[model samples]
Target chain A: MAGKPGRKFQLNEKQLGYAMVAPALVLILLVVIWPIMLSGWNSLFDYRLNDPTKSERIMTESLNLEEYADNRYLVEQGVNELSEAYPEGEETFNETWTVVQNHHEELVAEDAMASSYQEVNSMLNDYEPITDDNLRIQSIDGSWGSDFEAAMDEQIEAVTAVQQQADGDTAVEIGYLAAQLENLQGSVLSSNFVGLQNYADYLLDGRTWTALTNTTFFTIVSVGAELIIGLGVALLINRTFKGRGIVRASVLVPWAIPTAVAAMMWSYLFDGQSGVVAHYMAAVGLISDPGALLTTASGSMFSIIFADVWKTTPYMALLLLAGLQTIPNTQYEAAEVDGAGRVQKFFFVTLPLLKSAILVALLFRTLDAFRVFDLIYVLTGGGPANATESISVFAYKALFEQQNFGAGSALSVIVFVCVAIISFIFVKLLGSDLFPERAKK
Target chain B: MLKNQAGIRFYIFLAIFVFLVMFPFIWIFLTSLKPQNELTSFAWFTSNATLESYASAITTRPLFRYMLNSFVVSGLTTVLSLLIASFTAYAVTRLPIRGKTLILGLVLASSMFPPIAILSPIFNFVTDTGLRNSYIGLVIPYITISLPLAIWILATFFQKIPWELEESAKLDGATPFQTYRQIILPLATPGIFTTAILVFVAAWNEYLFALAINTADAWRTIPVGISFYQSEYTVPWGDISAATVIVTIPIVILVLIFQRRIVSGLTSGSVKE
Candidate 1:
C-alpha cells in the first residue's frame, strides 16, 4: 500500500514481509518439515541398510542385475561341470540349466529390466562395479517375481534330488550347482514396501514400550525436579544480594556446558572407582554402595535425572527469574500491609502471577527432557541392558547402529506424536499463551 | 531492619548454593590436573599436580581441529540464524502480515518438535546429497532448529524498539533496505548479540546431528570429539576430564562475558508470554 508513496523500485511493506519470510520459511520447510515428512513416509516401509534386499524404500519389485549376472555365470559353470561329472544325470542338469537360462532371458525381455540388464552386464564384463542403485536394480512384476522364485526353488530341489541319487564327484558337483542356483535366486528382489507395517511392529514391540516408558519417566522426574529447584533458585537469586551476578553466572555453568560434555563430566563424577560424587554420596549414606549408581537400572535413571536437573534448573530459574522481575514491588508491599505473611504473599501473589512462565518453562523442559539423547547416550550408552534408553536413543540405535531406518523412523514419529500431544495440552488445556498476540492486542 | 537480620542467613544459603553449583567444575578441573596414578585415590586435595592429561587431551587426538570445526560450524550457525531470524522477526512483529500469531506459533511448535524425530530423515538426506562430515551439512539443520529461538527473542526485542525512528528515516527519503540496514540493525545490536550468543551456544552444544552426520574425525565438534574418549577399553578419566574442561572453556568464557545478555535472551520470550 505504501509503494505508491514510496521511492521508486522499493517494494511495499507486505512484499518486503514476504521477502523477509522467504528464506526462513524455505529453510524451515527443507530442514525441518521436509525431513519430518520424509521420516513419516519412510516409516511406512520395511527399509534397512543391513539387508541388501530391503536396503531401499521399494514400491515395485526390482532385480539386482549385477548380482543376477554374476550369479548366472556361476550357475552356468556349476551346472556344466555337474553334467560332465554325472553323464547319467545329464538330462536333469541340462533341464535345470535351460530353465534358469530361459528365466534370465525372460527377465531381460521386459523393457525396464532389459536396459538395466544390458548396462549391468556390460559393467560386470568390464570388471566395473555398479554405482547407481537404479541402474543396477530393475523393476519387475509382482507375480513374475513370485513365479521366478518358485521356478528357481524347483530347479534347486531337482538338482538336490539328483545329487542325492548320484555318487562321488557327481554328487559334490551337483550339490555345488544347486547352491549356486539358490544364490542366484536370492539375488531376485521384491518390493520392500510394507506400508505402515513398521509402525505396527514397533507398536507391538516390548522394547518400544520400554523406551517410551523410560522417556516418560525421565521427562516427568527430571522436569518436575527442575521446576521445584528452579523456582527456589529463582527466588533466591531474585533478592538483592552481594555478588549476585557471579552467583547467577556460576549457576549457569552447568547449563552452559555442552550437554555431551556435561554428560561426560557427570559420567566421571558417577564413575564407580574414581568419582568424587559417588564417593561422597556413599559416605553420606545417600547410596548403599558407591559402585551401584551407573550399573543398576533405577540408579542409572536417577543419575540421568540428577544430571539433567542440575544442567537445566538454571534455565528454568532464568525463565522464572524474568517472570519474578515483572511482578511489581507494590503487589508484595500491599500484601505485607494487609498482614499477609511471606507464605501467604507467595501463594496469593507470586505463584498466580508466575503461571505463564512456569507453564512455558515446564513445556520446554518437558519436551527437551523427553528427547533426552546426548546426555543419556554419553553417560550410559543406554546402559548395561538398555534400562535408561530414551526414545531418541532407541531411534538412534535402530537407525544408525542397526541400520533399520523404517523402525527408527517409526520410533521418531512416536516421539513427534508425544511431543505434539504435550504441546497441545499446554497450549490448549492449560491456556498457556505461547504466542501472546491476541492477549497483547 | 527486618531484612538486615536475615542477611547472614541469606549469605550462608548463597554460599551453600554456589558451592553445590561449582563443585563439579572444580572437581573436574582438579581431576584434569591430577596424574593418572592419583585419579582413583581418595584424597580431597591433590598434593601433586601435572598438566599431563591436558597434554594428552591435545596431543593424543586432534582436539584443536575439533575446536576449529566447532568454531566454524557454530560461528556460521550464529551469523546465519541471526541474519535471517532478525528479518523474519522484524516482519512478523512490525509488518501488516496476516496470521502473525500463527506464524509465531508455528515457529515455536517447530522448535519443540523432537530432534530425534527429524534426525533420521536429515541423516538420510545428508548422506544422499553427500553433505556428510561437512560444516554446511551440520550448519543447515542447526540454523533451522535455532531459528525459532532467535526469531522469538528478536521479535520480543524488536517489539520494544520504537518505530518512530524508522518512520522519520523513511520520510527523509531512505529506502526500506537502507533504513533497515543503517538504522534498524544498528539499533537492534543488543538483541542481535543476545540471539547470536544463544544460537552459537545451541549450535556448538548440539550432539545428535553432529554425531549422526559426521563420521569423519575432521568434521567432529568438541562434544562429539569428547565422546570419542570412550573408545579405549581403559577409561582414561584424566584425559576425559581434560577434554571436558577444554570443550567447556569457550562456553564458560561466553557466559562470563555476556551473562546478562544471555540471561535476558533466554528468559525474555517465556517471561513475556
Candidate 2:
C-alpha cells in the first residue's frame, strides 16, 4: 500500500501514526535502554555500597578500600599511642583487630564451604587448608562498621566454645593468621579492571562453570519435555468435546499462578517428610529416601522439571492451539482423499502445517527456560551441594550474598551473550521462512 | 461411514485430554478445601472437606490489602499499556514511521535478555529515581517486558481492520485523534479487551521485582505473601493451597466467561476470517 493519504484534515496518517506510538516508544526508552546504559557505565567503575568516597562520584553506593584502610590505621594508631603510655596490655589490645577479621573470615569461609559444588569441580579450585578448630565464624548479619563491637559480641559465644577447646595465647596467633589470610584474599581484588576480568573469572571459576552446565541441562531437558507434553495435549484439546473450554482453562491455571506460589507449592508436594509424590516414589522403590528428590541432582532436576513442565505446558499448548486453528481441515481431507491413512495424514499434513507455530512456541519457551531462576531459587536455593544452581542463581549470590557486583555483572553479560547467540542460531536453523505467513501479512 | 468413527474418536480423545488437564486444578481446589491434616496425609479427592484453610490464609495477612494492591497495580498497568500499546501499534503499522522494522526488531530481541540481566540496571534506575518499592517502579519496568508483545499483537490487529474505516473518518473532517476515537477505536474493541486482560494477568502474577522492591508484607502481592509463610521451622501447605486456590478461581472464571475472547486475544485476532 502506498503512503498516499487522501487527507484534507490537518494531520495525515503518517503524522498520526508517529503521535500514536510515541508514548510506548518513550517508555521503552525511559525504562529499558536508560537503565542498561547506566548499568554499563556503573560496571566500568569499581562500585561499592560501603565505600563513602567513590559513592558520590559514581551515583551508586560502594565501599572504598582506601577509606577503610585509613579508618583502620587511625584506630590502630590510637591504640598504639594508648599502648605506649600504658605499656602493660599492648599484646591483648593489638589482637582485637585480628580477632574480628578472623571471625568474619571464618564465617564467610564456612558459608562458602556449605554452598560449594561437591563433584564436577576442577582441582584448581582447591586451596590451602584452614583447620576448623582455629577458625571462628561470626554469625552477625551483614554489617561491618560502628557495630563492630556488637558483632564481636555476637561471635563471642562461638569464641567461648573455642577457648574451651583451645588453651592460652596461642588462640591469638591462630586468629592473626586467619586475619592475615583474609587480607591476602582481599588483595587479589586489587587486580580487578571492571571489564571482562570478572567474566573471565566466572569462566575460570569451577563453581560458575558447574552452575552453567547444570543450568543448560535444566533448560534443554525441561523445555524439551514440556514441548512434547504440551503438543500432545494441544492436539487432543484441538478436537471438539464437552467441557473442552474448562479443560483448556484449567491447563492455563497452572501458568496463571505466580511462580513464587507455584514453586513453593511444588516444593511442598515434593517434600519427603509428608509430601504426596515423595511418599509414592518411596513406596514404589523409586527413591531410597523420602525427600531424596530434593537431595540429589537427578531428583532435584526431576522435581524442578516437573514443576516447569506443568506450569509452562499450557503456554505452549495455547500457542499450538493457535497454530492448529490456522491449519485448514481441507489439508487433512485432501490427504485422506488420496488414500492416506490417519497416522500418515497426521505426520504429513498436521506436522508440516504446524511447523511455524511449533518453532515460535519452542523459541519462546527455550529462551525462558534458559533464564530459569525464581523457580529453582525458591525450591532449593540452588542447594544440596549446588546441584541445582543455575548461572542466574550463581550470579545472584555473587551480587547480593557475596557483595561482588563485578562478578555478578560479568556472569549476566555472559548470560546475555550466550542467550543471544543461541536465539540467533535457533532462528536461523528453524528455517527463515518458519513464520512466513505472519511475517508477510 | 468413516466420518462417524472419526468424530467418535475425536470426542473420546478429547475427553481423555480434558481429564489430564483438569486434574491438577481439581486437585488444588479439593486439597484447598480439605483440612491441613488430610491435605498432608490423605488422598486428594477423598478427604473430608473443610473451609478453615482458606479462612486461615485469608486471615493470616491483610488479604484485602493484597487484593487491593494487586487490583491497583494490575489495573493501572492495563490501562496505561492499552493506551501506549494501541497508539504505538497504530503508529508503526498504520502511521508512517521511519525504520519501523528496526524498532520492532529491537523490541523483539529484548526477550533475549532475561530480566535478570537487566535487573541490576533497573534496580539502579528504581533506586536512583527513588522508586524502589513504589508501584510505578514495578509497573514501568514491567511495561518494558509486556509492552513489546502487546504492541506486536495490537499492530497485527490494526492491520486486520480495513484501512477504509480510518480513511472514511478522515474524509468527514475528523481530526486524527477524532478519527481514531470515533472510527477505528470501536472496531478495535476486541483487541483492546484482549490486551487489557493479558496485561492485567501479567502484572498480577509478577514476582521478582515485586518481591525485590517491596519489603512490607502489607504491600506484597499474593505470591510474595505466600512465600513468607515458608520459614525454616514450619511450612503450612494447607494455607498455601488455600491461597493458590483463592487466587486461581477468579482468573478461571474470567477464562470460562471469555475463553474465545482470550483465544482471540492470544492469536491477535488472527483466526478471524
Candidate 3:
C-alpha cells in the first residue's frame, strides 16, 4: 500500500552491510567465542562426571535433597532402634538423634532450602525419583552447611566410640547408625571451585609435559619433512610437463582422504603380520621386525610422521606451487642472462620470492599439526606407553574418556593458549604479508 | 642431446613421484578387493579378488545410512555457511563497513582456533539441549568452523569484481540487494561452488565432534562409523578397507574434477599481489 514499493523497507547501504554481517557475527560469538569462555570458566572448578559431589558446576555450598532425605530417613530409624534396644546407651543415642533432628530442622527452615526440601521429601514419600537437578539441589548458607557437616562427623565419631565399647547386636546397630550419619554428611555438597589448581597441578605433571613434547616433535619433524619434499615436488610440477593435470589430480588423493581413514589405511599398511609396508621395511632392514611399527615407541613416532608427511605434502606442494607460478619466467631468464646457474636461480629467486608462501603454508601446517588429533588418535590412540599422545588427544581422553571435566577444560585452555602463541609468532614473522593493502595505507 | 637426456630424467622422476603419491590409494584399493582369506597377505596382487568385502561391509553395517547422514550434515553445513559467508563477504567488500581489515583479520585468526579447545562446552551444550545426536547440532558447529575460510574466499572473489558494474547498476535504479542478488551472486558462483566443496569435505570428514556428539548408531557419520568397525575379538580389515574405499571414491572424483578450483580457493589470500 506504500507509494513506492520496497522503498520503505530498503535499508541504507551501511545499515544493510551491518545487517548482513550481523547473523554471522552473532553465530560465531555464540558457538565459538561463547563456548571458549565457558570452557575457561569450567576449568576453574573441580568438575567430574563420575564424582557426585563435584558433578555440577557449583559456586556456593549446596545440599542434594534427594540424598539427604533418603539418608536422614534411615538414620532416624536406626537411632530410634538403638535407643529402644540398649537402655545404658540410651542417653548417647538420644543426644545423637536430637543433633541430627536439629540440623535437619535448621536446614529445612532456611528460606532458600525449604521449598526444595519439601519437594524432595514429597517425591521420596510418593516413591518418585527426584530427577530434576534444580528441584533436588538447593544452595544453602555455606558456614551453616559446613557446621552441620562437622556436627554429623562428631556424631559419627561418638557412635563409633560407642560401637567400640558395645558387644553383639548393639555394636552392629551402633556401627550402622554411624554409617548413616556419614551418608547424611555426604549429602552436603560443597563448592567444587578450585581456581587455578588444575593448571597448577598439570604444570607439575609429567604426562602433560610428555604430551607437549610429542606434539612439538611431531609438528617440527613432520612439517620439516613436508616442506622440503613439498618444495621439491612443487618445483618439479610447476614446469610445463605432459599430463600435468593428471599428475596434479593424483597428487591430491592423499590430501583428500579423511585423516581418520588415512590413519586406518596406514594402520593396515603397518600391520606386523600382514602389512606390505612393514614387510618391505623389515626385508630392507629398515626395522628389526615388521610388528614394531605400531608397537614400539620410536617406530610409532616414525609412523605418524611418515603418514603426516605423505598426507600433507601435496597440500604444501599446492600452496608453494601457487607461489611458484606467480614468479614470472622473465626473472629466471634474466638470471640465466646474468650467468646465474640453476642452483643460484633457485636459491636467489625461488626461495626469496617464495618466502611469504612458505610462511603462510608453514603457519597453516604448523598450527594444524600442533592440534593433530584424529590422525594420531585413530592410528595409535596415543598408545605404546603414551609415547605418541598429543595434547589434543590427552584433553580428549580427560574430557570424554575419563570424564574429568575440570582437568580436561584446563588442558583445552592450554591448547588454546599454545595455539594463540604460535599464531602470534607467525603473525609477527609474517609482518605485512597478511595485510598488504592495510600495510600500504 | 643433453636437453633430451635431462627431459628423460625429469619424466622418470615425475613417474616415480606420481607412483609414490598414488601408492596408498592403490594399496588400499587392492586391500579392499582381496578376499577375506587373502586380506592379511603381503602379496602385491590377489588372483581371487572379489566384491565379498564390499558386500559384507554393506550388509553387516549401515554403511549407506552412515553415508546418508554424512551427506545430510555436510550438505546442510555447506549451504548454510555459504549463505552466511556470502552476505558477510559482500558487506565487507562492497559496503562502507567500519573496521573492514580488522574484521577480515579476526576471521582469519578464528580459523586457527583448535577445535578441541571448545569441545567441552559445546559438548555439554549439545547434550543439554537434547540435540546431541541430531543433524542440526552437528551442522551448527560445523558452520561456525567453516565460516572463516568461506568468508575469506568469498571476500577475495568479491573484491576481484569490477566496481564500475555496481556503480552502473546503482545508476539504473537497482537497489543494493538487487545488485547483490542479480550481479554479484551470479559472478561469484564459481567461488561459492569452490567454497561449497571445501566446506562439504570438511564437515564430511570431521571425526571428533561426530564421534563425541553423535555416538548413536542411527546418527553416526562415515568416519565415525568406520572407526567402530572392529569387533573386540578380531579386526575387520576387509570390511574397513572396503568401506573406506567406498567413502573415498566419491571424494577423490570430486577433487579430481575441481582440482584447479580447490587450489585457487586454498591459496587465494596466501600470496597477495
Which candidate has the highest TM-score of all?
1
Model 1 Cα lDDT, one tens digit per residue, B1-273: 013233787888888888888888988988888888999977767888899999998988899999999999999988888889999888887776776766777788788988888888888777877899899999988976789888888998888778899899878877666777898889999989988888888888999999999889988999999889877577888899898888777778888999999888888778763
TM-score of chain B of each: 0.94, 0.89, 0.95
Ranking by lDDT: 3, 1, 2
TM-score of 1: 0.90
i-RMS, every candidate? 2.3, 3.2, 2.9
Better of 1 and 3 by TM-score: 1
Which model, 2 or 3, shows the larger TM-score?
3
Better of 2 and 3 by DockQ: 3
Task: Report the lDDT tens digits of candidate 2 across residue range B136-244.
Answer: 8778777876787677677767777888878887677667777777777898888878777877787887776676667677778766777777778888788877887
Model 2 error, position A302 (Å)? 0.5
- How many clashing residue pairs are found in candidate 2? 12
Candidate 2 residue-wise lDDT, A159-193, digit = tens:
33343444455455334433432332231122124
What TM-score quantifies how close candidate 2 is to the native fold? Answer: 0.77
| Whole-model alpha-carbon lDDT for candidate 1 | 0.85
Query: What's the ranking of the predictions by TM-score, best on top?
Result: 1, 3, 2
| Location of the lowest summed lDDT over 10 successive residues in candidate 3 chain B | B1-10
What is each candidate's DockQ, to 2 decimals?
0.62, 0.46, 0.53
